[model samples]
Target chain A: MTAGYVDEMHEAFQTDLVYRSEDVPLECSPKPKDLEQTLHGLMKLNGLVIRSLEEIAGRGANAVTYRAGKKFGHEVAQYFQKRDDVEGALHELSDLLRGQYSFEVWKPEDKDSYIIEENGETFIYLVFHDCIVRQTLRRNGLDQGGPLCQTLFGYVVGAIEEITGRKAKLEIVHTGPNACLKKLVLK
Target chain B: MEIHVDKDACVGCGLCVKDCPMHVYELQNNVSVAVRPNNCMGCLSCHEICPAQALEHRGIYAAKRHYIDIHVCEMLKKVI
Candidate 1:
């Protein structure tokens, strides 16, 4: 299953490369093993990032982010299934990444400072660096950050599921700011 | 030859931006605008999946236009 998935992803990537304005990186390949590691690592890191976001966003913001992330995750699965090559998967995932979500950070309007809220809550802050990344990804619909993140998390989990042949559930919402999970559920 | 990304058709998916090993593509207003077209390595990636087919690689490979239909390419792949 992993090999199959990698084959498909590689092809998808190649197909996707055709849409590029330039030659694709010669580095892109059909390395299922590398892709597998990449997906798993990314999923883990995203889980961590969301936890950090919850801590920063406070007040059960986890639920909202989790929900959004989960939706995006489903899309990634669909993306992989749809494309026969890496390019197709990437393009499809790119489309998914275009989906909209909201994230906020501390601002002068709310308060120039951060505040911890109830539920072990704290200030709802949007990091400037994050915002920059988000804006850049969405700037020209090129990066698809939110959707990509959600889909990537989902893609990795789905890939794992395919590999293990065991159903895994991930519900990420309300896990607290620092809570991490193997699954995500919106609200 | 030079390649130009039709801004009107560009969805700015950034696939081109990231795919361009040459670092020739960039995102502008959620659309892909080729800033360094002269540096184009003449890869047809952008032209193939513009969704709107918004990219045209002129100059060198211009004559190769219509060399392969995408659907045909996919079909041929299955046969080969």
Candidate 2:
């Protein structure tokens, strides 16, 4: 991107512009099937691009994508008001990171607690049950926890850091077809 | 959260036993059983890799799989 474009995007995060959403007129509304088709096609294209980058950029693809995701996620976090506590941030973020990217603060059924405290730090597990990134990877026959997955880690860390004003880190605990588990540490 | 293992359909490949990150399943007497069902996080990696499709997860969150094409799902329904 050009310097001017980057500057404009950065400036957008500082704006207080309130916008209103209006329903699209019936004539302008796309058909449900057509929209699904478009979504599927775009995701497939996204998969292709990720795979191509994996092949071309090799290991560096992850760092680049992670940084990009962090920058974007930090910007997106501006939409939400900051919080005082990690638990409050988690409660609020679980809602914000929903719908298209449905996430749940998860724990084992046998475990009485989901969050653990140690060494003045808090740890929690976040499960990605309906992630677009997972869908895209699976759509293109790619493995989980690849470079694309790093973007999610970066995004979560960025968002949590911004919301709580704390340094947060995320680690992949497990990944599967349906859901992936990640551990977030706040200090 | 009940995990059902169909012994009739199980080929005893032990893929589920190997693939589950939580080590939830174990092969006993040539059948897969949820030996550590309490540990299962419901990721369903075992359900996906089963060659015989013998495992079933009930009362678990079925993650949205909108990535599957509508047309392809229909075609699979016809073929299966």
Candidate 3:
């Protein structure tokens, strides 16, 4: 199942890249295993830094960590743009990372929120179950919706902006240690 | 994968039954029971939501566990 998913993603990414620009050179990207390992390390480091800062800075750390996460997300979006358009790249990136990280099993909560397109705008809704961020926060006896969770929020925002070529809005409607609902609006 | 629900600790709140995306839990006689154990993806949403912490899962992907700094934990232990 995972292999098939990976192959489909790779094919989609390649197809999008070709469709975007004929002059863009095609090259082999890093193996999925390598990317997964690197992402694991990065997530660990990010969690550590965020946790330490939260301990020292208390509630004030939320903004600082959120900004840092936003920066990281922007960089990731830019990197994905090298191969495909913003939206396609972001979708591929989200799927690839989710499969690799094993953080949570995301499900579409509502049909309407699944994918809605109207008036040259798009809205996507995703529900994360058993997220690693929430698990870490619970283990540490911290509240949900803290900076750790905001990192993912910022990431989606940054990626959406890159894809839509417009600043998108993101909101977390509900959150708990085991589940979170996030909405992304593209205009 | 095995999921065990403690009957004694259960408050029958039905949170687990309502929250499980896969319908692994079902409320029977006002008590939550794991009816479709195979459907469980080991997301542990039930485990986290259970007010009495009545659920225990075994032989499932627990995901990577992150721990606090050992030195800090040790210091805190002394202070406590």
Tens digit per residue, CA lDDT, model 1, A1-187:
6999989888875743335567666765757444644543444565456556656776455346545645545544543454333324333433443433222222223234433253543322222111222332322233232333444344433532333333434322211111111222111
TM-score, B chain alone, candidates in order:
0.65, 0.84, 0.84
Q: Rank the candidates by DockQ, best first.
A: 2, 3, 1
Give lDDT tens digits, candidate 3, residues A88-150. 645654663573233332333233334567578776655565466765565556667878877
Q: What is the DockQ of candidate 2?
A: 0.65
Q: Compute the lDDT of residue B67 as modeled in candidate 1.
A: 15
Error of 1 at A26 (Å): 43
lDDT of each: 0.44, 0.84, 0.65
Q: Which 10 consecutive residues of model 2 chain A have the lowest summed lDDT? A: A23-32
Candidate scoring better on lDDT of 1 and 3: 3
Measured with C-alpha atoms, the lDDT of residue A13 in candidate 1 is: 55
Candidate 2, residues A35-130, lDDT tens digits: the string is 888888888898888888989999999998889778877888878989978778877777777775778787766567878775787798887888
TM-score for all predictions? Answer: 0.24, 0.82, 0.51
Docking class of 2: medium
In candidate 2, list every pair of residues with a backbone clash.
Answer: none
